[model samples]
Target: MQIILGRLDTHLGRPRQAQQRLRAAYDGGQPPAEYWAAVGARLGIAVDDPLAERLTAADIAGWLHPDPAALDLLDELRSAPVQLALLSNAPAVFGRAAERQDWTRGFQHLLFSGDVQLIKPDPRIYRLLLDRIGARAAECLFFDDRPDNVRAAQECGMRAELWRGAPAARSGLRERGAITP
Candidate 1:
């Protein structure tokens, strides 16, 4: 998921245009990888192109630069007495990349939409994650970059926050008692 954002930033190099393409794909019910490919094609780029291949590969980490804010949050929370789970609307490639990163062990359970065919903002996926984690909705605190996803999580009875950056996220988590100030 973060890799997709990075690809949009670095490869496409047009934030607004990339966001529009992503939104259009979401509206059309396409998965992230398909959406990326479609966007590339629309830009006259081919799937065989190195950038496209890297974005679509199972080792997308090679093409990704980790977001420092997300890393900070993970690092801070990993030592807390709380469970961490990752619920991502990502493809198998993203999962493969995550497994290669030993630091991702911070997450006790990882769920990807491609693996389950259940995307975010979908009520079922939220239920699935909660169930797998043995957590009640009220006991979960979810953070997402998308408003729709945050709303959906709230609808499912979990505490949801729109993550803007490290500071805001840290403050929110602290307020929720998920971490110390």
Candidate 2:
């Protein structure tokens, strides 16, 4: 069964530049490599520098990390009567980084926008998660840091919350009755 869970980045650290550049590129329907190359240029790095060639493949540590408070909350939620999932708008590199973290196996599924080429606020991706998990729309509760993504999930018939922080996330889950108040 699909269980209610919050977003990954809201509780984790990420490479600011890479994350921003990637999301913007994907949203703009442009390739991430091109975005990074341009970003490098802005930083005085030549577009043809080898750094530009491997920018996207940089180690996850070079980009994001797990937030301690968020991880603590996640640990608490792990015992709740709900399955967990990581819904992130990141490239495949982020997924690889997650694999090295202690919380990697905590989630039942890891959904990345790059994997499916469909970002949040796009109903099709939400439907894809539901279909892959064999859960009905109403059976899932999703949390996202972005209001648009949360609203999209609501439109897809799932209860959703805009995850602000640990306390906020806890309160949201409690309100949904996913956890005790």
- Can you give the TM-score per candidate against the true fold? 0.73, 0.74
How close is each model in CA RMSD to the real structure? 5.1, 9.1
Q: 118, model 1: CA deviation in Å?
A: 1.4
RMSD of 2: 9.1
Candidate-wise lDDT, in order: 0.75, 0.69
Q: Write one digit per residue (lDDT tens) for candidate 1, span 1-181.
A: 3544445456555557666646444433455456566765555554444555655563465534568788888999999999999888766556667767866788999887767767888899899999999999999899899999999999999989898888898888888787987
Residue 109's lDDT within candidate 2 is 83
| TM-score, cand. 2 | 0.74
lDDT at 92, model 2: 62
Q: Candidate 2, after superposition: displacement of residue 158 in Å? A: 1.2
lDDT of 2 by residue, 1-181 (tens): 0010112233225447655655555543445556555654444444444444455555345556677788878887888888888877776656666767787677878887767877788899899899877789889888888899999999999988888888888877888787885
Clashes of 2: 5
Q: How does residue 128 of candidate 2 score in lDDT? A: 89
- The residue ranges of model 2 lying beyond 4 angstroms of the native Cα positions read 1-22, 26-32, 41-45, 57-59
